[model samples]
Target: MHISRRQLIEGSLCGAAAIALKGYAQPSRWQPGTVRHLLPAVSHDRLLLKASFGRPLAAPPTLRAGPRAATGVRLDSSAEFFSFDLAGLEPEHTYELVLEDAAGAPLCDPWPITMFPGPDAAPDRFRLLVYTCAGGHPATVNSDTDSPYFVSIANRRKMLLTGLSYEPDAMIAVGDHVYWDLRSPVGSVMLGNAPEARRLVGAFTRNLPVPGTDNERKLKRVVTPQISDLYGTDFRSTPVYFVQDDHDYFENDEATEEMVTFPPDDFMLRLARATQRLYYPEFLPDANRPAGLPSSGAADRPAGVSESFGTLRFGRLLEIMMYDCRRYMTLTGPVGGFVPETVEEWLMQRMAAEQTRHVVNLPSTPVGWSAGKWGEWYPDLLQPNGELGTARPKYLWQPGWNRQHNRLLQAASAMSGVPLFLSGDLHALGEGRIMRYGDLDFRGNPVVTVLTGPISSGPRAWPSAWRGTPPRTPTGIELEAGLDPLEKNGFSIIDFTEDRVEGQMFNWKMGEPVENLDNLQPFHRFTAARGA
Candidate 1:
């Protein structure tokens, strides 16, 4: 049965109204929803976990990993969430953690989490699960129907479970973890855009408020289904590194007469930060990482963890320098880039260090593919001829963005390890070898880039559906295409070893039965050997 957009909105509003009435009667600080999600981040000797509860606990819960126990610290910012920071754990050792209430009854099922290998400990192999665009409520912008664009929430959970079954050491979710575009002038099926939609769906207030206030309540209503409801306790075992893109800031990376949403304003930043604090764990601090990086403050956190830039070190084998490109992007023409100069210097320094046997560049925005969006590195515009062309003016795109892009690629190519970059935001699954960048030639050691597939985009959300064009290789860069960008819903499982990195891309298109995903296999695979 086909459901109209208006019908969907009305039904959702009805449910919201019922929830509001129940909350008013209960008068609880936090509404008791069935949304207990756990996100963990780990280092060689420590573990940081952020978990939410369905209801306010009678007292603080405790997490027991073998004989070591850590009491949950209630975050003052969120009512039903707790933080557990445990240090001095044995590296590369699996700890089965049991969460119990103050009364010693099990709160949730026990989960097994493993710490990364120690800094000097050389691990034989490590596996990473990576994907992007896994944000959207099946009932909001899209119905719970199967499409080439999006799948049902149950199916998305199944895919996550399948990936988790692979037992990856860590997971990297590149961007678009949520899809609530609040202030776009363009009419979108995504909730919270237009006035009627905002009113019908719900709106987060303009003012930032303390936790347990009406503002947090409104914010939770908008993000919970997109996040906790979708990933409830499933990733309890795996360490997840979440990088933010435009939509995570509650807007699209769009530039029109009415809005230029990139380089987020203060409210957006605060809202984004607050959402992360409530829903996920921030990137754990690294000793060598600069303390002054964006959001690397001790405020409300145990220590200074970088909310924007992060480093994932798996012993002496792999180091992934992941940076959020949307938070600190500037618009100063030739002087502006996706990240600030300070961050660029840090990234370049890390690339030069080569402390690990393998170094992969993980950024929110992809390097090889472009849908001609305004926020890309290249100044290519989507021409009326349905092609991307640099001859046309791309509004608000800076020359410095491309310059930074070239510099980063060149640095990666110069490194001793295979120049492999895994990125998101392209809404596709593809791989290409970037052999040249304008005047720069890297034929001797070409840089390889991959688009880790989208997790939750439905038919209407694809670039071809919304922007009127499929992603293409940007002009002026010669790319030897391995898997030309294919719009689908899937992810990549990458295995890293001392001498090589291997990847398998698994995806499913429109009209496919969701049940098929239970036994999905890789559609494409590739391997990059270590540098001599």
Candidate 2:
């Protein structure tokens, strides 16, 4: 469903049609479906949209500057889809992205596009969100009869509203955006490396004749629409950076790192495609992978499937190293630790930048704390693994990753501002600063680590308090942890400026008797400055 750029912007059937004037609400012939998904993704540079009966008749959507100001791709399935980018937008200006019908009447409510401050714009202030493990299975039901989807949707809406109230410039959804409907048991037992033709007997769906098929279809029903409802208003105006986790990738807590990238027919591959297609904006290659991997419409594009790591910047105040720790990962490292080769270089460069006030390295899996069930990362591996009669491979101190981790820290120490680590998955809110064990150089440059989670999912049980005595990893990088709190169901916030970076964990409840963001206070708060 590729419509050439010329057809969209040029005078097509919709060009001369009656376009609804801006800022005024009017009746529209091109009615949107009950669900209209208008999401702002990528940098402040792109807009992603999905609406039923949502496509414009001929002329492309009219931006603040008009129809001709946009370019990129448009895709249509049962619903109308779009991923158009607006380049050359003025810095700090808010643009209106409006869709219309053949008659030119605006189809859905117009969305606002806010551009980041320009290169010359003051690098003074910006706000970012860090969140993960949003609502999913084992429904936190309002009523016993309510389905998991119903309960999850209610919670998701609350989280979105709370976030919008903060008016963040952008959001970083760290991972577990949507968990597979099946429980974690399925993931542990089956394998992502299985052949595509191997079909599981029960692929669940919201409504199915056989009652247990369309595993991919259930995702569209149970999760995607909830996302549509959650970010309904805010996404139109703000960018949402998606970093996927195991559930969204394959099963519950695993990404298939098979040497061979599976073909389109594979179940796991099919599941990944469905998640990206219905909800998230299309995938783009990181600098590590070449861009413009060919698309076959049904198959996951080459770079799209392979590349998950990328970067984001805001004025000169901040730069983010968004890591894809799950995909392309092995039990141990060769050159790349948990991260891919291309992304490691990109992150290191940012950490070393003199003008970059803050560099936030976000891994979908936490390096600070976790449930200890998963085996790959630092926190998860620290917990005892009964299967091994020991902890998972200690990557933090192991030869494979130790050197890379040290290099990353050294990069931070060499810069003007101490870089911060942002993570989620512990289902708790915690903050801690690192020091080379037993060394009281607390006044020296320190790396800050902040953890927040349980966006709408059930919060995990975290220790009321705990820390290692001069906690030393395999490689002897000594550290300590503190201020950890559990049952704080919400997202993390980071407010950045040249002087300091402040973090807070705000709480949000899932069901009836809705709570107010204003009345609630942060469960934990911490700040990172130039010199510890």
Candidate 3:
């Protein structure tokens, strides 16, 4: 059961040789599963593509336009993964991407990719599929009783594929993409006490080389099953933007008397970075976004890969500014926030600019609701008696986070159009119209906040089941509940246009027939009209 990378390769070669000897056609190294994943993100004239293989490629693969046979440059790569940055592409044009060998033989099947509209070009409509908490393997956590993922990975995949079938223009996956929590107290308890989980997930090594060392192999073993193996090439054609949350760093966001597990340690940061480099495409550069922000344009990162913040611009119609709340979170008392001061300024400026008809603030942490968790913007605390209270200060909750949250909400409410925010990490699907946050009132133009539903969390993982109660409106905020938070495996299809933004939420519960999932339909619907 414990197979080394070299041994796995040797075994694969042996099987391939046997097939060749029996007069069967040999398989291409670029076949699906061998070339583990291909994830691409696009702009009007630029495309960034990332692909990883089961084994290292003997030579760099070429990306070509299937119709015109145009070539794309292969960037410098590491180990088993490579990236491609295709520039000067035509906007709103569809190009068939063909992966080929050195000799020009086709490697994998041709995949068609379309470029987005330019910043100045306004489209009539654009649709997006948004979801969160999509990463987890049932075997890697506690057993059936304690903090278990009640559903199987295959079931989760079906739910995702169902969402994909809706044919949205692009996809936004909010955080908790991977759930291999390691160092935090809860992580330590879940991983240390679960021997079977260790056998299934492998171990995390510290202070080791990133790409070439044995530790890299161990890291691959742990993430492959959760990411590549789970989603495969299902998202290859969709321009997918991934946002990272606390669990993606391999630790739950928690502060304890023993240790503070955020602002990720050097090892945790390296692990998360390496995972992004190997499996997924980072946010491509945007002209309107500053390149000097936290991890954006950092020297250590691959060229054009932005780590902390990104943007999704569909001409002048819609723009989604996505930021990772965990990476740059600071703990300094009243000034500390989930995002840095620079990022906060950038967000406010972007929203105030009113550059697009529909502006969405997408963060990894949800607002307008709380289960009294430590990482939330509100200071509400989950007491021992399973009641939520704000009389006591949270373990390490920063007041600045709430201050920044209110500031953003105020800015959004004052915008010309309806203020909208889509977020995740609470593992539920719901929406709230924030009428007031603290003393700032938005009754005239209530800031609309939404939990975009989770993709992989099972029954045991719901906040109500684990925290002993469901999420509720926090103490300092007054909200009109449009849709109460419901724990299920689901996603949202949001349609953006010049007039209004409409969304349909779809979900399916466990203990039900899996076949029925294929016929799933939107269970809830809501629309936010433009203007007051």
Question: Which candidate leads in lDDT?
Answer: 1
- Total clashing residue pairs per candidate? 4, 3, 0
Summarize candidate 1's per-residue lDDT along 237-267 as a digit string, tens digits: 6788989988899888888777888789887
lDDT of each: 0.79, 0.50, 0.78
- For model 2, residues 181-227, the per-residue Cα lDDT tens digits are 24333332322221211242234432432112456334545454446
lDDT of 1: 0.79
lDDT of 3 by residue, 1-532 (tens): 1222233222222222323222244554324535667778899988877777766666777787533443333322444667776777888877778887667776666666778889999799998889998887566545656555545667677677667666778888998878777777766555422576567545665877566777676677677777877666666767889899998888888887988989898888888888887767788888878888888776655566688799999999998999999988888988889999888998999999989998889989988999887888889887776677777768988888988898888889889887999998888999879998778899988899989988887776788877777888888788998899888778999999897999999998777787666567899999999874
Comparing 1 with 2 on lDDT, the higher-scoring candidate is: 1
lDDT of candidate model 3 versus the reference: 0.78
Off by over 4 Å in 2: 1-35, 42-76, 137-151, 181-219, 254-266, 282-307, 332-336, 379-403, 437-443, 459-482, 508-518
In terms of TM-score, how similar is model 3 to the real structure?
A: 0.90
Model 1 regions lying over 4 Å from their true place? 1-35, 76-78, 142-150, 187-189, 194-201
Alpha-carbon shift of residue 255 in model 1 (angstroms):
1.6
